[model samples]
Target chain A: MKKKIICAVLIAAVILLSCCAILIQYFVGGKERIAYIYSDDKLVKTIDLNSVEQSYSFVITNSNGGSNTVEVRRGKIGVTQATCPDEICEKTGFIDSPLVPIVCLPNNLVIKISSSENENIIPDTVTR
Target chain B: MINKKIVSSIFGIILIIVLSSCNSQSVDNRAKESETDIFAMDTYMSLKAYGENSEKVLQKTSDKIKDLDEMLSVINEKSEIFKLNNANGEQIKISSDTALLINRSIEINKDTNGAFDITLYPITKEWGFTTGNYKVPTQARIDELLKYVGSENIILDNDNNLVSLNNHANIDLGGIAKGYAGRCAADIIKSEGITSAILNMGGNVQTIGAKPDGNNWKIGIQDPNDSSDIVGIVEVADKAVITSGGYERYFEDENGNIYRHIIDPKTGYPAETDIISVTVIGSDGMTCDALSTSLFVMGIEKSVEYIGTKHDYDVIIVSSDNKIYITSGIAEKFTVSSKFSEYTLNTI
Candidate 1:
């Protein structure tokens, strides 16, 4: 009976430790995948979510497709370039969150950035 | 032995369920769904469409339109617009949707130099364009109504959310409202993770991502001479293309003269020009829609010159002769239908 209790305690400890490891990894490692903008499986831009001053304006495109010159400044991102008649994508204005994608339908492109990351990464505090 | 096996099985089952649930949740969080569905609305008057992240939101967007109609219909005196209009030029606080439209109208009007005037409603009312019963208003009546044609006369303060008209000017936003709705609909779709969509608001279109097959959207520009005929086609992606023409809504006089709904603000009469249709492509649907009318009224020469000097705008002018002229910027994206062998591309 004592042996069974020991085994049960050990199993429970292992499970709890595993869950903790997962939670830490998710909060830490998952963040690395988020920079500023991810386009075509590459880190196109990385942003500091906390600093309200952290903003950028850049354009990206390949030879096959037309350029999608996006402007990111003051926590807002918008399309500034396209080959289409209606600059609807530029009119989409600034998208500050990852949920709201700045998309240009005619250009087949999307620009989005992680929002909460700006809040969590403080640098000084050690999270154990 | 049997009891031990049962205990182990229960644990295993619970573990699998928990693990699977977490996996699915994580996947759901990463992927977002978005969509823009285009279809006809009111038979011939306008095209109604909505974009959303989920089917429920899309339905809600449609439902919101229905609700908006109840509030915006001129016939409904109790509606928000009617109440606002009846206030003897008093400013009225409105809902978010109405506010968004009002702000866009004001912005477009400012940007277009009164050429895209929504306050032309007074003149339009005289012509009965909104009534669907078209008639030619006399020159005297047109001149009388032209007094209230200035968009600058419409006072709007965004911070205070106040709107007032200096003259007896009645604002009708129908010209750019559909395009505004297209922009809003696209916003909803991007939130939903619907990567691919095509939104056709009657003649104005907004496309996002690409077709599932990964090709651009083929938008057909109809020939004003024949509805069955397509003058040309323009390939668009992640943008909007809108057309305005004096031929869209018009009535012929006894002299066999055609007067269309697109009245020139300067003359308070239908714009006379050989170019029947003007399609403007821009990043914003509302801008394109409003500019399409303004540039059409401005005529081919001035329109071409104006857009030529400006950056980030292009136009396709379809002439009365079935010939098409695309701006130098967008000439490459337009393709002529072989059926119209006589038609050729001209970029001046």
Candidate 2:
């Protein structure tokens, strides 16, 4: 019985160690970050967040006279101002993950992020 | 006792080896799933394929989509639609693909009782939706444009692949192009022996098969009020989920009034409805794409009635009043997110 207990504990420890190794590798390894800005459903700019040394802001204007002010800082990006009535873009703040995007419907603008390693693998289209 | 100990020890060793093999196999399978995104049809499109030949299949599918974009785009000065639109009341020769799509559109228009019309291009252009310079046309101007907004005005001669427009009507395939492209992409992926894939054209989703792990794909439904929030999620397999919402594309006027891009062919105005978004799920992408727009314009009561008559697709309608109406066919597959829990959920 004592031998059996030792064997079970050994198996459990091995499983635990493997799980920790995977977690450490995933969280500790640096990930490459990229952000894409689209205006009127057209990709207008691509930014590598890791390469952004200084924070900057730019303006995007659509054909309908609508505009969005986008700000990019280290490791993150967001829309600071927009002419849309809802102001949803401004409220979205900064996004670091590719799961969500900053969108201004009135201006027809979207900002999305993705890891550089998986950047090419990012699906071509997302529908809301 | 010694024999029992040996048996248990051997079983433990086998279990360890099995577990380790599973971990490595999962990693290998993940690497096999390949994806690519392209810009076409004035929208972002993504294709993901799973299997050993995923990379090759994805590339071919992307090229197919690009080819379709060139052939069908109304805004492209050299496209078939553009050439046909510029024909000015004269019969023009069109490719069989274009003719087939037009014929399908005409059939759908008749089914929807003119709720969906391809000849609303003049009004769409006047509203500046096509050019992104939006202007609310006057009621009188809308009346003038309405005369040209009828699908019956389009005549197709299937024998010679000829198409003509009456009263100088112009055709725009913007409403159904993505869905059509998605359908064609699925065909390509399937022909390549890719059993599992997802084709997304600006929110029009077409699944080639169940997930490789034998699970349904979980698709999130965006909240019309909050762009970042997902109001619900639906599990689906081998299906298309197409959404049409006022929030998808719109412009704010100087007076702060928001006008959506979906023009109601009957009123010559942007569709005024209580529903903010409509998500349609079906086996065919084109039908889902067209119906999402048509049902959105139909509003709540009419949409429910119309859907009851049709049995091919199911819908989830999010109304401006914060209520979600899901048809019974997909109610079991859909889960309302916590953010929208306070809103009423009616399974019809």
Candidate 3:
């Protein structure tokens, strides 16, 4: 009976610690010039902006059945084109910093940037 | 017995993690479960709220903003403002929302002495700001349109929701409509008992209440010099932060002269001011929106004089010489970026 309880506690602790590890990875997990593209709250793709030796563009089909053409340059990311009605994501131009987020409402796409050791200081949104 | 205990313990930890991140503005909220983004009023708007009935509240907020866009948009031919502007100076019955905004705009104009005039639509249209085809109106054309530049020309019958132009004039609520939409969204969310929410309506921001942990929401001020970065961050709860900058909209003529979209109702030309960027923080989004533009047009000296310890709202401006002048109301709330630390920070 004692052995069974010890094994159960060990399993529970592993599960809890793994959850903590995920939460930590979320905040400061090897911060780099990374752009996380989420579609309907699901991370669709990750791009290291610093590693891109050349510029490239691709379309991502979203949960809304619409699609956005994401353009990745050497140091920035933007929605070059989108099937979304507003094209607000494209209008967001290019964002190289986490301060700005590129969003397409109709397509339900969100592009966020995170970088460097100053990860704790990134802002939620920027007002001009 | 051990299996049951393990199941309950793991489940409890999961619940704690979820609940703890519920109102957090950190890593998880960016991936927030209850959030919506909509494009309305010629700007992109994002709403994020936590707690009960968030989806329903967000949908309702979206509907309200769409309705406001239909009612307040000047460029939309079907909008009430468009109809009223084309009414040939005749009395028109408008919605109560329209009447209230018109009245409030006049009051702001009076307080700022015409710096926040809604009657600049005719002059704005002449400069092609209404449409994207930009141009510089001749001085004669500008001066002619400037005749109808007073908000006093807008007459409203409050009880009956009636409005009319006492003189030949046109009006546009672009300045305050977005901010009003933010206020409405916040109110709707708060009414639904969702106290923790943040909205980004284009560049304007509105917070409903404190963060879930009771900390103030941290908002960054976009660096006018670089849209990709921010100049400073302000921490606040239940307030609206609106900014007006020359870099928002502008056109360069063939001669390489750049003219921003913010026209001086007084001069009928792009406002030539000592400040290039002005931000207003207040509890009322509409007032913040109006003052952001009004202060920009008022220039730095007059803006400092105008805000003059009212304590109702605060202003932060970056002068042409790169000095930062902030009102005493938000002196402790705003922190300048290290890169911008080279500039002087003046508390007015």
TM-score of chain A as modeled in candidate 1: 0.48
Task: Please list the residue runs of candidate 2 whose C-alpha ends up more than 4 Å from where it truly belongs after superposition.
Answer: A1-69, A73-76, A80-97, A100-111, A115-126, B1-26
Interface RMSD of 2: 5.7
How would you encode candidate 3's per-residue C-alpha lDDT over B311-344 as one tens digit per residue? 8988889888989999888999889988789989
For DockQ, the strongest prediction is: 3
Interface C-alpha RMSD after superposing true interface residues, each candidate, one decimal: 19.9, 5.7, 6.2
Please state the Cα-based DockQ of model 2 relative to the true two-chain complex.
0.21
lDDT of 1: 0.63
Complex DockQ per candidate: 0.01, 0.21, 0.30
Off by over 4 Å in 3: A1-29, A32-50, A57-71, A78-93, A102-117, B1-33
**Candidate 1 chain A: 10-residue stretch with minimal lDDT:** A119-128
Candidate 1 residues A1-128, lDDT tens each?
A: 76566656655765676677667756765543222554443456665543446656567774446677766565456677766333445644555544234444444455545544433211110000
Scanning candidate 1 chain B in windows of ten residues, the lowest lDDT window is: B38-47
- For candidate 3, give the lDDT of residue B145: 89
Candidate 3 lDDT over residue span A1-128, tens digit each: 88677867776786678678767866656457899998876888999997899999999997557999999998799888877543457756899988878877667788888787465677667788
lDDT for each residue of candidate 2 in B168-197, tens digit (9 for 90 to 100): 799998888788888888889999898999
Q: What is the lDDT of residue B188 in candidate 1?
A: 68
